[model samples]
Target chain A: MKRFRVLDIVLGILGLLTLLWIWHLVTMLELIPRVFLPSPAATIAALEWGLVNGDLLPQTLATINRMIQGWLLASLVAIAVGSLIGVSAIARAYIQPTLEFLRPLPASAIIPVAISIFGLNSSMVLGVVVFGAVWPTLLGTIHGFAHVEPRLVEVSRLLQMSRWEFIYKIGLPNAVPDILAGMRLSLTVALILAVVGELLTAQEGLGTAVLHAARSYRAADLYAGILLLGLIGLVSNYGLAIADKRILAWKN
Target chain B: MAQNAAIELKDVSLSFGSNEILTGIDMSVEPGEFVCVIGASGSGKTTLLRMIAGLLPPTTGAVLLHGKAVRSPTRRVAVVFQDYGRALLPWRRAYANVSLPLEASGMPANQRPARIRQLLAKVGLANHEDKFPGQLSGGMQQRLQIARSLAQEPDTLLMDEPFGALDAMTRQTLQDEVLRLVAERKTTVFFVTHDIEEALYLGDRVVALDSNPGRVAYDIKVPLPRPRDQLTTREHPEFLRLRREMFEIMNKIHA
Candidate 1:
């Protein structure tokens, strides 16, 4: 098993090298103008320079900060309110239809309303990020809490669990798998919204840097920004996956 | 008889909207007695057990526990469900699963480990406390459920076909284990099973419930000798006679 994992990682790196080779070939041949797509070396150079001298590190931090704040806020609220919607039939009847209707409304579409409310401030961007990232965890929490086994509920009842005890012991633990999956998904959504929010507000983040690079026709810088965002997504997701494995180890 | 009864159902009838599921059911169990109720699939044996556990309320009658009307589940009664897979939380280790009732009852966190260890030891799962329900075999999972039930420290225990899903050999061993455990505790037990021989093997008395509108068809006393061995008692002429009688009654209900 250990050897196979090493082999898998080696093959994955090889695949990445192949993609880079193809990208370099495309740029060298000028299939799409160099003005539009920079060579891999140029992109790599920009990345190095951005980290050493430019705002790359701080902008990356800013975007991550926004994502984490929005995600944490969304998760806390989801667990709280989602339990209500999950456990209470009356709450479900009233809130579920409204949620279903709102679930489909895109987060970007909320930007106009958010701008009207907060007027291009950092809070406006945070609002958009929260709006976008909240759905997956919220719905997942509700589904998880609602689907607890009937027999377990009977066991809980026979034990005479208080309402809080029932939710904590049975409801929350049952919802962990679903909630974790939702949290992973919401992480990606949060990153996207953070970037989008930064771009619209000219916030001091990678999104703003990318926008500035695009308008100035700095193709290498733009590509570098995109590359850095991809790396962020990959690393954050990997971190969450490790947490998921550790928390759900007993599942095995 | 009803005065000192541990559990009593007084003319209990259950209706679902317009559909009557159980009608005119009356039974009383003395403290520390093992009463096994057996019937076919739709016989409302499970419904009766649920009423005793206070999981459901009979539409027309009262389910009383220790002379008090059972409005809802009380901590004094523990239920071991048939679907051990669903009954035990898959996320929880065996120790935590058994700790559920203790946690609900607000046992001090520091005191829980010893109690949990003792309960797991009771069901022969002491070393398997770290295993998850999914990690354990079906029989082990059922034992985990039993251990968890024991943690409730109930005055009465209700089991709905608790061993129906286990293989025959496993079932026999668990039956013997349960009898020994019940012998130690003064807990009144209400066991429901479709298995005829199981009823005779486990119960001091077996109540056969009729289906459609479930009611007691016949209640027979099992005077088979105590400390019943699975091999010897199963071969006992009296055990065989009761088993045959139970089968005949169940067949009549099915017909």
Candidate 2:
């Protein structure tokens, strides 16, 4: 594993170097203007300047806080409602059409309405993120619970396990992998919605930094902010993947 | 011996959506009696065993345990299903699977380890206790399932084709081991099988069932002596006679 990680890092460095070389060649050939497409060095310099002089760190923190709160609240509600629907056929039949009606409406489409209701605040950002993140988690919970092996359920019942015991022992354990996969997917969607929310209405955050740079024609700063957003997304996804591996180590 | 009748079924009948599976099933098993129920596929042998284990409800009649009707599965009656791979939980180690019944019984935590060890040792799986069912071979996994059922200290054991998935050699060996263990524990067994030879080999009394609304077609007693070995029991005159009789009964049922 250590050898593999080292090899991955080496390959990554080579890939980055190749990209930089191509960029240098393109810029020297005047394929794009310096104002339109800043070099990597210029972007780095802009990143350092933003980190030192602007409220970049604070805005990043604010974005993260809203994302976490929205994602967690949405997950809790999704699991509760999804599990209820999973166990009861009548409940599923009654609620499924309404959920279907609501799920497909894009979270981004709700931004204007949220801005009107919450007045361009964190609440508006949170509302959009929650709307985007909840559906995958809810569908995951429903699928997980609905597909529990009937034979295993019979075995548990034959053991004279209580309803609570059946849920904890057989139900929850079987559903963990599916639930985690949903969570991972929802987290990615939540991150996208967070940036979208900020870009649409917020006066702060990396999205705001990017928008400001664009308006002022600071191409380097815009590129740097976009890079930072990409890095955050990559880190979040990798972190969730590591967590999933650890929890489901028993599986192949 | 009469006082040791662990289970009794009085006109026990089972139907699924108007199709009668088992009808007019009356049988009594004494404590420690290894009674094997043999029939063709879909003959309701498994259903009868499930009813005895209280995993299935008899539609019209009742299954009695110690003179009381059994409404649901109780710890006193445990079943080992044919699918050993599916029977044991994959996430749990062999010892944990064996200990599941004890855990469900809510036995104090302190005593569980010792009980699990005892049962695992009994099933000759002491060395493989830490391994999961996936890690073990088919025979080893089935042994683990047997150990799990035995951990409940059940008065009656209902095994539905427990050795059916095993190779012929492993099946015969496990059959001998199961018989020896059953003899030691003196637990009443309702062993279901489609194999006439296996039924005759392990049973104190072999009950043959006919297909299509399965009913007991014949009951033959094995007069072979106790502590019988594989070779000696197969060579015994009574064993051969019983095997022939069961085969004829099955042949006629199919006809």
Candidate 3:
């Protein structure tokens, strides 16, 4: 199994190299106009320049800060509300339909509503991100807390545990695997919403950078921003995967 | 303590909508008594144990603990479930799993470590205190569950086929260990199992249940001697006779 994992990483790197080669070939062959699809080399040059003497690093940091703050807010609210709904049948009956209705509504569509509330600033961007990123974690928490093994429930009951004690000792710990999985998914949603919020609100982040670069026809710079966004997504997902592994080490 | 029964059920009946699970069940257990209930599958043996533990309320009659009607779970009774894998907290190490009851009862943080350690040691899990339930073998996991139950410091234990999932060899070892521990602590035990001989080996009295709305069919006392030897006790004339009787009754119920 360990051997497979090592081999798996090597295979992943190979697959990435293959994709890069294809992109390079496409640009060199002029399969698509260079102005529309920048060469790999041109994109890399733009990325280097942005990091060395441009506002790319700060832009990247701003986007990350906004994304993280929004994700954290969503997660705290999700877990609190999810736990409440998960533990009670009556609450679930009344609230689940409303959640189902809101779950699939587009976050981008909510931008105008949020702008009206928070006035087209960072808070509006934060609001949009929170709205989009809250669902997966919320649903995951509800499922996890609700589906705790019946035998454990019996044990808890026999111990005569208080409601607070039951949640702290059993409900929360039991839901860790599901909650983390939901958080991982929500992180992706958060990054997407953060970029969208930044673009529309004219916030100083990668989304605005990408949007401004497109208007000026700086294809390489636009591609560079896109590349950085992809990297951020990959890295954040990897970090969470490591955390899930550490937390669920006891799970086979 | 001497005057009141440790556990009592008077005409206890339970129904889920239209289907009856248990009906007209009446029994009593003295303090420190080891009573085992035996039945085939769907005999509501587990349901009966749940009622005694106050996890399920009977549709008719009452479950009494120490002369008090049990409407809710009492801290004085600890439950050990058959599926040790599910019974235990997978995230917690053995020490922390045993600390659950103590923590729930608000034991002082500074004082919990010693009690947790002692409980783990009592269940022969001292060396594996840091191991999670998933890391332990079947027997070890069940031992961890026992340690967790013991942490409650309960006067009575309600065990639902706890050894039903173990291999035969592990089952025998745990049976002996349980007998030793229960004897030492003088804890009243209500043990449920489908295994006839296991019921005979551990119980001071064996109560057999009939299925299709479970009711007590037989409640026979075991006249076997104390400090039972797993090998010799199985071969004992009275043990063999009682085991045969239980087997016959169980088979008849299936028929």
Candidate 4:
């Protein structure tokens, strides 16, 4: 395990170096116009300017906060409703069709509706992020809870566990791996929707900052914004991966 | 008579829709007696055990326990399932699996540790307490399942082919452990298995069921003496005689 962690860091550095090398090559060769594609040096300077002089820190934090808030809300609600539908036949029958219908519609398609309701605000961005993020977590949870073995169910019954005890002890724990998997997917969706919401709704966030950079033809700022977004995604994913390992240590 | 009976199936019949699984399964188990039911795959042995455990309802007649009709599973009854892999909570360590019933019974937190430890140690799983069910071998997992059931402290133990999946050596070992445990605790056991020899070995009486509208076909008292050894018991004249008779009957039924 220690060897693998070191190997992972080495591989990560190698990947970053390779990406930077490619950016340098593209600019050095003048393969694209300077205005359209920024030099690696220009992008770094833009990153410094954004962090030191611009609102990059606040904008990045704002985008991440919205993502976390929406993702957490979706997780809590989905875990409850998904588990309910997973275990209860009546609930599955009643709620499944609507969920299935709504799940397939793209999260981006709801942007217009959200804008009309909440109107160019943080709430509108949140609504969009939550709507987009809930499906993966909900569906994953249902799948997890539904597939719990019949034998375990019988054991629970034989043990004379109360309704709540059975659900908490057996149902929830059995669904953990799936729930965490869903949460990870939802987190990804949350980030995407957060950006999409800001871009479309003209809200103040990293997404809006990126959109502003692109409109003004500030290619260096655009590259820096995109770089920051990628780093945020990588960090959050790493955090979740660590958590998944710790929580489900018994699995493997 | 009914009050003294640990379990009684009075003309109990069960059907899934129009298809009958068990019919006229009339049997009685006295308190502390071990009864084994043997049959082929579709012979309703498991169905009978389920009825006794109150997990399933009979289409006709009644399943009674301690003079009361068995309607649903109670704390007084516990079951050890055949597929231990599925029966055990993979997320929980062996100790917590045993602690499940104790916790459910609303036993105090402080009281649970001793009981859980005792149950795990009873099943010879003391060293494997921290291991998850997935980490254990099939035999060890089955022992964990047994430990969990024992923690229930049930008056009646219903086992459905609990050792069917284990190898010959593990099967023999578990069989002895079960016999010893049940004998010590004076717990009433209703064991269902496909193996006729196992039925004869562990049971005070062996009940064989016929398939195709499954019903009791034979009921034989195992007059073999107690504290049966793995080798001597198998070699006993009475054991050989009963084995022959049961093998012939089972063959004829399959034919």
Candidate 5:
């Protein structure tokens, strides 16, 4: 394990160096104008300027807060509804068609409808993100809950576990891996909707930053915003991966 | 006369959809009797055992435990399946697995620890109390399953090819342990297997079941005395004779 970690670190460093080298080459070649494709140094300067002068920190905070609210609310609703449907054939029969119909429709397509219904504010953005994120979570919860081993179910019945005990002990634990996988997918979907929501509807956040930089023809600022978003995505995914490993440590 | 029968199946018939698995099966297990049901694959041996365990309902007739009808798995009956890995809950420790039925029966939490310890020691898994099922070997896992079932202090123990997956040496050792344990506890056991030798070796009565609507082809009494050891029992003339007769019967059924 120690040797593998060392090798991983070395490979990561080499990959970073190669990326920097390519970035330098691309800038020097002037294949695209600097205003359209800024150098890494220029992008860094723009990032610093935004951090110092613009409403970057507050807007970033607002975006994160909205994302958390929407994501969490959607997750709770999905789990409750999905579990109900998973446990009951009639409930699934009634709800499945509606869910399937809505799931395939692009969440962005409903942004205009959200704006009209919730007004041109954070609620609209939240609506979009929640709509996009909930499907994966709901589907995952249903699939996970439904796929619990029949043998385990028999065991639970034989043991005379209460309804709640059956769910909490056998059902939930068995479905956890699937639930986590679904949440990971939902997180990515939430991030995408967050950016799209801000870009299309709001006057602030990282998405708005990209739009403003694009309008002003400031490529360096645009690249900086995009870089920050990418970093956020990488960090969120890494955090989830760590959590998944810890939770499923019992699994072979 | 009726008090001695731990379990009874009268004209028990079982079917899956249109295909009948067991038909007109009549059997009774006396108190503390070790009965082994042996047959070929697809022979309704397992189906019959499951009916007795109350895991499956008979298509027709009744499965009775202590004279009451068995519509579902009774608290006094417990089963140990062949797949030890799948039989145990992975999330629980060895001690927890043993105590699971006690807890389910709503045994007081304060008294659970003592019971778990006693059962673990009985199964020779005292040191493994803290270990999870995944950490145990195939043999150890089987022992854990046995411990868990025995913890229930059941009126009858139902095993479906319990040691069928183990190595020959491990299987032999476990068979000895099981016989010894059953003798000590005086627990009635209804064990099922495809191995003819295993049936003869462990059972007080070896029931040979034939397939195609499975029913008992023959019921042979094993004449070996109690507290029989592996070497001595195998060397006994009666044991050899019974084994050969069972092998022939099984072969004829298969053919």
Candidate 6:
């Protein structure tokens, strides 16, 4: 197993090297303008410079804070509402058509409406982020709660378990795997909305920093900000994956 | 003077709209009695068990527990269903699954550990307390289900084809285990199964039902001695005679 892990690391480094080599080749050949895409060294230098001088860290932190706030809000509401609809047939029938209609509407499309109401502030950005981030979690949670095995329901009944006890012990645990999967999707949505919200709202976030760099033709800074965003995405995705593994250790 | 029978079905009849499932399933189980209901696939034996467990109400007549009509599942009763895969919570460890009923009873947190361990050990799963139900084998999962049910310490257990899905060897082992446990606790059991031999071996009395509007066709006592061995019990004259009689009745129903 240790050897296999070592092999995997080796292969991962090799894959990175291959991608970097491709980028180097593309720059050397001038297939794309240097103004449009900076070289790897130039991008790294700009990243170092920004860390040393600019508000790179602050902007990144701001974006992340907004993401956490919005993501948490979405998760709490979606889980609450999803479980409600999942358990009650009457609620599902009444609310399903509206959810179906709204789920398909692009989350980004609501930014203008949010901006008009909340007007270029954290609340507006948060509203957009929450709007975009909620669908995956809501849909996944509803599916999870609806599909708890019938026999388990019978077992709960046989135990003469109270409604609260049944939901807490059985319903919630059963929905967890699906709920986690939904959160994973919601994380991606949160990141996208965070960046989009910043760009639209003219907020002081990594997305705004990238927009600023690009507007001024600072290709290296633009690439550096974009790279940092990508890295954040990677780190968060892996973090959630590790958390999922730990939480669902009982599962095969 | 009270009847004190653990369960009584008073001419219980069930129908889904016009589709009659069971008709006149009249029976009474003495306290601590082991009664097995056996029949073919469409015999509604499971439906009868469900009625006694109060999962389904009889369309006519009533299912009573200790002379009181059963409206819903009560704390005094527990059910061990056939689908152990679905019955045991996939997210829970073996010990936690056994602790579920204890927790529901609002037992003190400090006292749960020993009780959970005791029940797990009773079902032969003491060493596997931390393993999840998905990791356990089919037989082991069934054992976990039994352990969970036993934790309730219910006066009556309603088993719906609890051993039907198991392989032959596992089925026999579980049958013996269930008998030993129930005997020790003096828990009244209403075991439903399609296997005639299983019914005879495990039951004090076998109530055989016929299909197509299911109703009791044969009610016979198993006079075979307790502490029955798989080999010697099968070899016993009474066991074979009862088996032959049940076989003929089942055959006639099929015909």
TM (B chain), model 4: 0.98
Best-matching candidate per TM-score: 6
Candidate 1 stretches greater than 4 Å from native: A1-11, B1-3
lDDT of 4 by residue, A1-252 (tens): 899999999999999999899989999999999999999999999999999999998999989999999999999988988888888767777888999899999998888898899888889999988999998889888887777888888887887777678778988888889999999999999999999888877777899999999999999999999999999899999999999999998888
Q: lDDT by residue for model 2 over A163-229, one digit each (tens)?
A: 7776667666677787788888888788788888888775578888788889999998898888788
Q: In order, how many clashes per candidate?
A: 0, 0, 0, 0, 0, 0
- Tell me how each candidate scores on DockQ against the true complex: 0.81, 0.56, 0.75, 0.81, 0.46, 0.84
All candidates: CA RMSD (Å): 1.9, 2.9, 1.9, 2.0, 2.5, 1.7
In the range A1-252, model 1's lDDT, one tens digit per residue, is: 789989988998999899999999999999999999999999999999999998899998998899999999988888888987887667777888899999889999999999999999899999998888899999998998888888777777778777788788889988999999999999999999999999999999999999999999999999999999999999999999999999988776
Please report, in order, the local distance difference test score of every candidate based on alpha carbons: 0.90, 0.84, 0.91, 0.90, 0.85, 0.90
Show model 4 residue runs off by greater than 4 Å: A1-16, A200-202, B1-3
Highest-scoring model, DockQ = 6
Candidate with better lDDT, 3 vs 5: 3
Worst 10 residues of 2 chain B by lDDT: B1-10
For every candidate, what share of the true interface contacts is present?
0.95, 0.44, 0.88, 0.91, 0.35, 0.93
Candidate 5's iRMSD: 1.5
> Model 2: per-residue lDDT, tens digit, B217-248?
99888888877788999899988887787777
TM-score of 2: 0.90
Off by over 4 Å in 6: A1-13
Candidate number with the higher DockQ (3 or 5) = 3
lDDT of each residue in B70-125, candidate 5, tens digit only: 88887788888998888787877898888888888889999999999988898789
Cα lDDT tens digits for candidate 3, B136-237: 999999999888888788899999999999999999999999999889889999999998889899999999999998999999999999999998999999
Clashing pairs in 2: none
> In model 2, which regions exceed 4 Å deviation?
A1-25, A52-54, A112-119, A201-203, B1-4
Q: Please give the lDDT score for candidate 1.
A: 0.90
Ranking by lDDT: 3, 4, 1, 6, 5, 2
